[model samples]
Target: MSRVAPLAPPWSKQDADGINRWGHPDRTYEPLLLVRCLQRHPALTAKLRALGEALYVDATLPPRLRTIAILRICALLECAYEWGGQAAFWGPIAGVSEAECDALVTGADVGWSAEERTLISAVDELEATGSWTEQTWTALGGNLTDEQRMELLIAVGWYRTICTLCNGMDLPVEGWMRPWPG
Candidate 1:
């Protein structure tokens, strides 16, 4: 069961407007777990929504690398709501294979290139120690451009914030999506 149940209708006037703005026109709260749960604080919801959209739209980081890092964070944090949705919806589009997705959950770096392994290691280290080791930073410098490195740091922090929200609320997975493996 979810730790905090999602908001239901008849919502406050502000919340109703927020639902319409952030949710589907059909009145379904299908993919708005984060949005719907925080809609009572419309300002905060809008800011988070904008930040999430901005992270995706920014081209500084390649989507595949970005997705890998995000997935790793999700798995490390054990946030099924975030992990399941990203693995099912975003992974394929970003060229992350099912095997790679599984590896994220299992902490197995098999089948990844040296650079990819380093990236995963960075994510792991960040979760474990709250900072990347000097070795990981050197590896990233060799593989990623300055802009990409910056994007990577921002992306990691961004996804961590998302995982906190998703997990804190125990957001339910979308019906069309499978739950992350136990």
Candidate 2:
């Protein structure tokens, strides 16, 4: 069971519109425990929904680069719910091979090119120190455009927030999705 049980019944009805908006396109929130919990607060849910669309759904970062940062954050935080769903759905579409997704669980440096490795390193630094070191900043500058660099930082911060929510709420992975590396 989740540490924080999702809202039920009348509470759910309280934010039906918000629920419909943020809920799955198929009208199912069974797998998205975070949305279930957030639905209780309609205003907050809308804000979160917009933020999510901006970060992941309508992101400007290359699909591969975005997935790499997201998966790295998921792995770092051990947010299996996020990792499982993202790896299964977005990873392949974003050009991250199954092997690469599996390897992300070990560390960001595994099986990635120098540029990608540096991107992962940036995530690590941000998670650890809340900012990238000067060395990593320089390495990243060589490969990423100012826009991509900004997107990378935003993506890292966003995914880490998601990791916190999933971990804190104990959101369950959907039945159809499996965590990376089994």
List the pairs of residues colliding in candidate 2: none
User: Tens-digit lDDT track for model 1 on 1-182?
Assistant: 56666678788887776666652233433636666677757788878767776777656788899999999999999988888878877788899987788789986656898888888888888888888777778899997987888788888888899899888877877775547765
lDDT of each: 0.79, 0.77
> Which sections of candidate 1 miss by over 4 Å?
9-29
For model 2 the TM-score comes to: 0.84
What is the lDDT for 21 in model 1? Answer: 69
Q: For residues 76-155, could you state the per-residue lDDT of candidate 2 as single tens digits?
A: 89988888877877777788987788788865335688878877778888989998777888888897787878888888
Stretches of candidate 2 exceeding 4 Å from the true structure: 9-16, 23-31, 108-110, 180-182
Q: After superposition, how far is residue 147 of candidate 1 from its true place, in Å?
A: 1.9
